[model samples]
Target: MREPVTELAGAGATTAEPLWRAATSARVRDLAWCTLAPPLLSAIPREFAALAEPGGAALASWPPGALAAWQRWLASADPDLLPPTIEELSALPGAVQALAPAARSLRLGRHAERLLHFALEHGEGIELVASNLPVRRHGPHGVQTLGELDFVWRDVARGGTGGAPQGQLVHWEMATKFYLLVEPEANVEAMAPDPCTRLQAFVGPNLVDRLGDKLSHILRRQLPLSRTTEAEALLGARVDRSEIYLLGWLFYRDGVMPAGLDALGLNPAHLRGWWSTLAQWAQRVEARSPGSPGSLDSPGSPGSLDSSGTSGTSGTSGTSGTSASASSVRWHRLPRARWLSPALVPEHETEPFETLHDALAARFAEPHRELAWRREAPVMVCEMEPAGASAPGWWRERSRGFVVPPGWEERARQRAVQPPRC
Candidate 1:
């Protein structure tokens, strides 16, 4: 496992403070690739790795955002367990089906970890040691605490030559982040080895949260060697090694891949989308076709997914000559939490553009309700085309965009203009 660069101790800094190092902006791209590749490669289109091996058949069904979310879950899951493709999900085993409803309901991050823990605990040939272990030491000044390790698992490595069994202990760290590319021209995008002047190329909505800070905090502070003593003592075993399991979704401008992104080492298949304010989304809906799908007074009944389970001829596939009129377009506002992966919208939950507009209007009319706008706000509009009768619950993106409060672009631009500061 590759380690992050270490920050040397400052004159009067405590051990933990000194461990708070930062990776150069360029490293973020490499780390992103490192963070993302395992999940992508491991995500064999619903455990169809053997089937998806040739001619990119697996890649066809695996969208970047969806695949990232799957792999993220698999990181801490049983190694032998496989992710099911959308098609396979239609007929899961009864045992899996029993858990499917709750599993499906979980947010992407938590869902993945939960499935992983279940798989590990139930699988054979390996023993589950511990999870989310906390370590602390009492100093004369006060109690000093190290953060939690996601898991401590013992790998039973069989000897190649039929020798004695070798059990290696590993302290695994896990995290998932979804960042949007804000400045494609920054040196960080180029993946330069030197420290980044600033953490502006890609960012979370808060602007302060970034790939650089996340990586630095993990590598420098979280996984430092100095803390190993306490970790091992708490676990009652010597740790052989530590590893970082990182996963992420890097969203780009919807419909348009910005210039210089290629230079940033971003996966070409990385997920992309657009954002706008609620008012803007309403305007777009009005311009396309007002009061679409014929009913907003009773938003309860829209369209239902045909029970056929076949990847039908219409909808996201766009085989129908619908031309994506507003009425033909199926839109949904993503849930505020865990909005990274393209939230797969079941056909039953989908309504017309008018439905969302009416729902938001009613929501805001509740008097005390507050609407907060942020770059990472949940006002994500997933513009999916209507699927024909055969493919139910399998909506595809005709186009996707985000709805931001006014002046978001200017704020992002202003941040981009400022030099990267160390």
Candidate 2:
């Protein structure tokens, strides 16, 4: 039985202040990862962690901003069971068909990003992040916390629309992966560890990369422990680990993420930047922490067997032509948010939508409606050429744009191919 803390007559001890304890804990944790910008990142306040876990949502579809708002609300709620009263928390699963808009996830419009270096440097595997994930990285004779890691795959970059009304990382997507977000970690792209210290760690013996005459260049530049990301694109300058693992896998293969992401209800913008962010973090964290020998005991490989269920074409596979060419990819289902009328004349208040964008709007415009809501699935397809690819080089750089595919034409003519829920 535990005894209540009755003060001993001779003892002069007192309970430590949470603020003081947190500060010291943060300082030590900071020193564990970086020395240059030792104070930039702040500890994820435990208070934020206190948000209520609204059980799982039994949603057929989610409204646009609903998921992000819920996640943010959860992240801000009590970490304990108690919530901010029902008025402040509603756990009802929203209907997938119609979701209302909500605030975008932002640390002042900033979002979590992957440490590309850590991911790119680490060997390969899909990073599986469990919310309130318990990442135990063994450090010098002890262990350290992989702070407040969100559920984006360790190797893939993930995010939603970021369109005018960007969709949040949907609640359902987590449902598909068992709420597990996976990414790669072996070919670290961020966390710049000391050269001497890295040599000491027992990793990188079975690296698949070939050795080169510029062996030193590859060693310093392309080795498994190297960290990398493009600094130009990181908006809001905040570090996020959402896609760290995804970047790792992408470095190995891009198909790993795109084909399967929509099933999780993630928007595309964040997904696009996963790799670049991982690179940035791997370099930065390594420069800071040096991940001393055991600080980074590559979280055991998930082995080939465990990866069986993950079909190569899961996230963005069906959405693009290149992806379509690889395998018969079926997109993780998304609620049908179709264009009822042809993409509205581009408002006609400004310059035309190049000719392709304008023609696409013109050619694809026609009223669409679900047939009695019976099998109301949104029709999607990929178009390889747009007005014959404006200029030749654009196709290679940005090959295809996701517009109404030719397949929709059949549905428009038939009308009943898809029925609306209401």
Candidate 3:
């Protein structure tokens, strides 16, 4: 039960929100959240903990009081210290130049990278030295690329001389992942006995990525990249430390966490959500319909879905259980680029549950010519509620989850057991 490193601000908040959310631009809000959200895992799991040691692979450490600095900055009343205006951000670098609408097709990982790049360049106690620096070697045939360094920066707060950052140089590898837990067996008690083996059960929606494989790569390859002679020569400074910053949600089936997962070293406060096959989702929706018995709005339910579609015991954020009517609420399909922030949709843009279900069915049934890999891919859907008087004609995301096509779970189980192709 490791504590989260920072307090989170929900997306689509209007009033009494964090200062960063006050920005008028959607990109800015996403950037702020990406930079400040809690890491997916609190620390390297015990199985890989040895790789994080000083003589092995160095773990990332925040500069003294760095968290306090961010808290102060986020809470600052000074206009200059608040989140940068869109126009101001647009002028900073080419990485963010895509903040405009034209860059909507950018992958979520690249988008998060750009946002973190912005934070390191402008945020307190840090200085961005380089990003996406490639390491190459001249082979017998031609030049070959080994790998790229995600980020290298200086911790100015740790050691600075006359306001100039003269501190330990750090190499950081980051990833934004969304994995859904897969269970091959019907009986939970019959699951894998080994904790690391159990961790392999979390798989990406596309069935191409697994948590176990990713963790192994980060510990064995990515973190050690900075220590390579090729990387050191390119950086011009030996990396004093290396850290892995993993963020995003790990979704469970029907919003339920299996027992004995605490051994994985996952942060108890990590963002989470639920995943369901289309059939299961339809059943849940039918069960929660306005006239159904023991609906979601029923008194004294154990928990309700939050704006991010994660399960929460307290119904404070987004649409509360008692506030939103199941009949009137609509659903929105989240594009990959929009995954980072809680969605905000125009009232007219959303569709009824029936319409959404049909669309999903059509998508899953049809083979995509251009994207053959995505033919049966799971879709991320968000439940929406009216934004009230302050934001009339708009809707905000209340809860979100993944809806997979039939047989997707079996494929996911197969993929989970296979080694991740990093």
Candidate 4:
């Protein structure tokens, strides 16, 4: 009999709490998807092996964090959402293989959306109506492209489980945001019209991307697309229904919850990451990886690094697993798109550094790094050494989380908010 697909990568090894199993746990799996689904059409079921050429590397190279992000993205496919029932998720090898190609490019966030599209298309009773449809209006001056409809889909069975109707069309607006919490006091004066819109508390790494501005754009510019003549000409009908599929992760310093987080209306299932300053990161890494200055490496802690195993999944409740003195750990620079998810280190992917200083130096030197980490850094999940029984010294990522710098909240607030340029 053929073996089941156990992880995003191929399955030539034993299935002792594989990455797939870790990501599919009942809690995080469901939580991750709460904010992540969107409706799109269906496609032919191609063999898993067929995707090896165009998208194999993208799928195979998904770090632990990206997979976690993917899981959360899938979790967004809950029944109450606007999509049809994805009955094919349980098909194991076929489902994984079919979805693997959706992540053809290394763009992590885009891949998650592609998988969502694939999942919706793979549903039992769903059909693709349109995607990335352009809406342009011919004004007195000339034809102007108002905006693009992210996706337009129809559920052949109407809706999942509820049996709403048949051929129900939906306009889906899918988005992902990674914002850090800040004090509303900083911009209380600037928020003239509505001083207390929840947007005051959360801001992106760059202050320009405020929650208020996004909501304003969606409600004003995006939602109105249905009424435009351009959309009607393209879709042949007014969009019967519309919904926003907004998915995101919030980051904060370790053990420091923002003052007004509860009021933000953020979904409880929203994923989180911790941050630390470069100095703090150096201290933690050194503390965790015990050894001489030159020979720095921490051995694997006891017990299998499985969520269902004895350790019970670190970084979930804002904690981490124990450090192994002899095992080696690597500090990886997470992709900006994948920061909201876990960063998994496969056995072959563990490139340990000689010191914490070395890791930070290399990461900061990279051009186009997330500028938000100027004073603080985000630490992605790292695996403890002696990977699995099959591959020693090959540290496999076991969890998804980050550690942030101290006093970031204050610094975030001190930065002046930029006025929106019309």
Candidate 5:
């Protein structure tokens, strides 16, 4: 959660504004924030704290002034300083077309990787040596792919100062993840007392991944890959350091802060969202509606609702006023590829809450190709409001959450207790 830098010199700004807020394009804003946002966890948990030290697996080496330059570039009004990729993206006629190149795949992780790749390729002070570099070895069966290196780069500004020598390479592993916290059931004693163990409470929406396991894999395996003999030969330069760029939102159950959160070493400024079963979400919305007994200002309410229970303005876009009632707030089901940023969508692309609910009901009630079993899958939904008079006919996301099917919580909890496959 670093403070936003003030507008660049000669830009005529006396106050600091968030970099994302300065960008005219939502996609570019997301890319800018992704490049500069702090890691989700402030530090490695105590269990793996030793790995963060020098000569350990997770040491980071950033070029001097690189972050500040990026921040300034993102916020600068000067067209000459803008990255070519961002400038071109900003000029696209439609949001979907602009995003299609980076979001070619549905995998959110891949989408994040593409965004970072674009930034590194076009931004200053860093030379991207290679990305998605595959490591392979001959096995008894045949050539086996060990793993892929996410990024290997050279810090153009390093070597002269106290930093590593000028030509040394740095390895970086990056991931964008979203997980919902599911507290353990009554059997608390069954789990270990280790602080890092609490990370299991954060599980992926599909229940196949956990934060603890992801961290363990990065520290034990991915970060060490660049130092291996095969990787060294392929790289032609010894990797002097390895780092991670882990970002994404963490959702809580109805916005409740669970206990022992300090043990997880979560970044205080990490992005957050709420989660609820479809029924629970509907109930909360109904309870917060105008004239309802439940107060709109109550703790753990779905999202920002004014005294009249209408949608509140989203600070990201500088839009103001209550343009829609609580019940009329538009919702768009976020496809996996579009989950990285606060969405900017055409008016026709969004639907009212009732329409969204009916669609979700149909989705859960019917069998589909993606679902192998009879169970239902959770869908991410974004609550959108008018983009104000500045961008009329466009809607922007004000808040987002996952609407899970019935019985999904119990299943997710069960998955949380099990060992992560990774």
Candidate 6:
């Protein structure tokens, strides 16, 4: 407790591995193997309780208001809980505002606006919805044709929509661009239901949360959005803490976070591995409609697969009790596949694809070599004879696909036969 230990070494003084380590070193520096400097592990959720000292406030050397905000957040478990309307929150005593710098959401909202602008300018017809974005925020309102753009804008956020907006946006196209939007902590029905549907319910009396500002910024931006509203609507429903962590980590690790990720928090475990994060975004990209890949788009009216998703999950549900009763969870295991930027697939990541080669590999190689799992879907290559016999049964005969024609190869060679410009 002497000199307010800023790190583990100063706090522990005597280096020894923790036996049943739970309590932290007055400063919450984690006890690692052999007293190594922190490995940049993530902060546990809302455990800022670790920051308090009995009667004193958080950040003992800093502002008391921050501790107050942190404590209030801790009590709610949902940082955005009892969200004082934009009016109420903005008008808080300067003491509270001084404590929680995150409450200054002007920058956060502005960033969102920038995102919408960036997305709308991506290609053609993409729309960046303002907090007051139109249900039909596209085409004639500003569009001309395929691959051609229409419009975009930015403004302060307002009720549900209003806050000090970092910015605002609207677009006409469905392809080419995306918005990384943020949401409040408590709303559930408005957000997309996730893979672990049962675990994320923000209601009932017991739930935990994350660093709100950081979570909202990362998830809304890094994860990609079919449309700004997809996320906007979902935010009104539930909070996806893991997605927030993963997205925040992605931007932070890449140095895109406004002040850098370490400036706030770091948690690789909650965010999952880089491989998985890449996989998640890659899957989202692949899931977009088959409209052109380089522009803001109007995909024959969104939801043509191209309309895309703002939240990570689809909006509808299988509510029939009969269907639910008949449903059985069938789990299947497959090899993990490397994530591909779905938009950049085929041309960007070439593979020697042919049921012939893959089937051959699967029959003789291990499961991973033959079968690949992209997202939750399985893709196994296989070759089968006309006689209804498959060399590698695990490799589905359906995968036996066409090979690149020699004519295309010759054309490629001809195209490569260019005169050097000196």
Best by TM-score: 3
- Candidate 3 clashes between residue pairs 3 or more apart in a chain or in different chains: 309-400
For each candidate in the order shown, give its overall lDDT on alpha carbons: 0.43, 0.20, 0.65, 0.44, 0.65, 0.23
Taking all chains together, each candidate's TM-score versus the true structure is 0.55, 0.16, 0.79, 0.58, 0.77, 0.17
Query: What is the clash count for each candidate, in the order shown?
Result: 17, 102, 1, 27, 0, 53
Which one is best on lDDT? 3
Model 3 scores a C-alpha lDDT of 0.65
Pairwise TM-score winner, candidates 2 and 3: 3
At residue 358, give the lDDT of candidate 4.
61
Scanning candidate 2 in windows of ten residues, the lowest lDDT window is 338-347
Q: For model 1, what is the alpha-carbon lDDT of residue 323?
A: 37
Of models 2 and 6, which has the larger TM-score?
6
Model 6 C-alpha lDDT per residue in residues 1-422, reported as the tens digit of each score: 12111222132322242211111221112111111111223432233322222221111011234323432322223212222222233456553464334234533232222222332233132223332122223455783322211222322221113433342232222111111111222233343332122112211100122223223322333223313344445333211111111221111111111212232343322111111122332343244334423111111211111212111112221112111111111111111121101111111122222323344334333346334322122222111111112111111111011112113223322322222111
lDDT of 5 by residue, 330-419 (tens): 778887656765666777889977788878877777666666332467888887766555456667666677888888899888877786
Report model 1's TM-score to 2 decimal places.
0.55
C-alpha displacement of 235 in model 6, angstroms?
37
Kindly report which residue pairs in candidate 5 clash with one another.
Answer: none
Q: Tens digits of per-residue lDDT for model 1 on 1-422? A: 12222231111112221110111111221222233332311222122222221222211122244335443443333222434322233345554465644344334454445434454454444456876566777789998876766666665642312342556565556566655556544443454333342334556654556654554455555555323678767777666555555555544432223444333333443334434456755654565443334211011111111121111111121112233445556776665442433333455556777787666555444444253432234355566654333334444344445555455655755654455433
Ranking of candidates on lDDT, top first: 3, 5, 4, 1, 6, 2
Error of 5 at 2 (Å): 32
Error of 4 at 377 (Å): 8.7
Off by over 4 Å in 1: 1-112, 122-126, 158-164, 184-199, 225-227, 262-265, 276-327, 337-341, 346-348, 354-378, 387-401, 414-422
**Cα deviation in Å at residue 136, candidate 1?**
1.1
